[model samples]
Target chain A: EAGVAQSPRYKIIEKRQSVAFWCNPISGHATLYWYQQILGQGPKLLIQFQNNGVVDDSQLPKDRFSAERLKGVDSTLKIQPAKLEDSAVYLCASSLGGVRGTSNYGYTFGSGTRLTVV
Target chain B: AQSVSQHNHHVILSEAASLELGCNYSYGGTVNLFWYVQYPGQHLQLLLKYFSGDPLVKGIKGFEAEFIKSKFSFNLRKPSVQWSDTAEYFCAVKAYNTDKLIFGTGTRLQVFP
Candidate 1:
């Protein structure tokens, strides 16, 4: 199976500038996720999509962070007016999203985009 | 609200050494657990998961995790580790009936030959 794919493996931008990261999940995956991993810290879930609709975004900083999955497939995460704290690895993941009995909570993650906010 | 905890920030071991990494979760509802590992310059991959019927779940590369409901813990273990085992391991949890995941700060294991 093709793993989740992310683009622009690295990015650099000045503070207050905006940037967007793209992701293409494995075929047939129904759930997609965006996560932020800071240096020396664990990955934090920012947003999740079930098909083309959002399933969760409670952890997303709506004021600056936004994400969208179009046509139930590819997705993008954007950070407007980026802050220094926004410099981190952005990971995209996809899952079968079936019942716990079926999928067994498995997830496939992309290599991630490393963003540096200067 | 739910969160995951990993006790070790980093671990170093020689070849053939035993390994154990602790992970705990705080959630009032039923939960699902997972352990993911990322080798250097690689994407995160699922090592194992625990849903039901088994307290001890075996995963790829001889890794295993025991889920103890009473302790709210799922600790990963391996009998003998190789230098190839060096990587960052993350423990994640999902509340039953939910689609989101909560991850713990990773534990970086560096195995030496």
Candidate 2:
């Protein structure tokens, strides 16, 4: 099976600039997730989408970070007015199901997009 | 709120040595636990997962994890590790009723041949 796919393996932007990352989940997966992994830290959930509707975004910094999974297959995460602290690896993951039976299928994560804010 | 803890930030071992990485989660409910490993220049991949039955679960590459519900822990273990086992391991947890999968700060393991 094809793994989750992410674009622009690396990106560099100045502070206050805007950047976006794209992701294509595995075929037929219904749940998509976006996570930010800072240096020396675990990957933190930024947002989650069940199909095209959002299931959770409680941890997302709405002011700067936003993500959308349109048509329930591909997702895009955008960071506007990027801050120096926003430099990190943005990871995209997808599971075969939603909240209920997701654990059974587990998640497949992409290689991730490394962003560097200068 | 739920969280995961990996007490070992880094570990160094020689080939043929035993390996153990601690993982603990704080969620007082039915939960799912997982271990993911990322080799150098590679994407994160599942090492193992525990949903139910058999507290001891074995994964690929001779890796296994014991899920101790009483201790709120699922620690990865390997009887003998190879230099190829060097990588960062992450522990994650998801509550039964939630869609969020929280991860703990990864533990970097470096095995020397």
Candidate 3:
């Protein structure tokens, strides 16, 4: 089975610039998520989508960051006016179902996009 | 709020040595625990998970974790580790009632021959 796929494995941008990361999740999975992992830190949830609608995005910084899964199969996360603190790895993951823990399934993550804002 | 903690940041061990990595969480409600491993130049993969029923769960690559509800801890362990086992391991948790996951900072393990 194919796993989640992400692109532009690595990216570099200047502060005040804008950057976007793309992700294609596993087929048939209904739950997609975006996470940010700073160096030496765990992955932090940025947003989640169930089908084509958002399930949770409480941690997402609306002022600078936004994400969307238009057709429910692929997703894109964008950051505008990037800051040095925006340097991190953006990971995309998908699960077979969206219900909390009813199904015994673990998320399959992509290779991730490493962004370095200078 | 839910949070996870991994006590070890980095660890070094020779091949065939035993391994134990400690993890604790702060949520008082029921939780679903998970252990993920990321090899060098690889994506994070599930090592094992504990949903309910059993406190002991075994995962791929000879890895296992024990969940002690009393201590609010779930520690990953392996009787013997190979050099290939060197990787970064993370502990994560999600409240049984929600889909959001809270992850730990992770532990880097280096096994030498």
Per-model chain A TM:
0.95, 0.96, 0.97
**Model number with the top DockQ:** 3
TM-score (C-alpha) between model 2 and the true structure: 0.98
Grade the docking of candidate 1: medium
Q: Candidate 2 — what's its lDDT?
A: 0.93
Error of 3 at B66 (Å): 0.5
Query: Which residues of candidate 1, in runs, are more than 4 Å off?
Result: A98-103
lDDT of 3 by residue, A33-81 (tens): 9999998999999999989999899999999999999888899999998
lDDT of 1 by residue, A1-118 (tens): 6889999899999999999999999999989999999988889999989899998898899999999999999999999999999999999999888553354558889999999999
| Deviation of model 3 at A117, angstroms | 0.9
TM-score of chain B of each: 0.98, 0.98, 0.98
TM-scores for the candidates: 0.96, 0.98, 0.97
Q: Each model's RMSD to truth, in Å?
A: 1.5, 1.0, 1.0
**Model 2 clashing residue pairs (backbone):** none
Q: Give the per-residue lDDT digits (tens) of candidate 1, residues B1-113.
A: 89999989999999999999999999988899999998988888899998888899999999999999999999999999999999999999988777777899999999999
lDDT of 1 at A6: 100
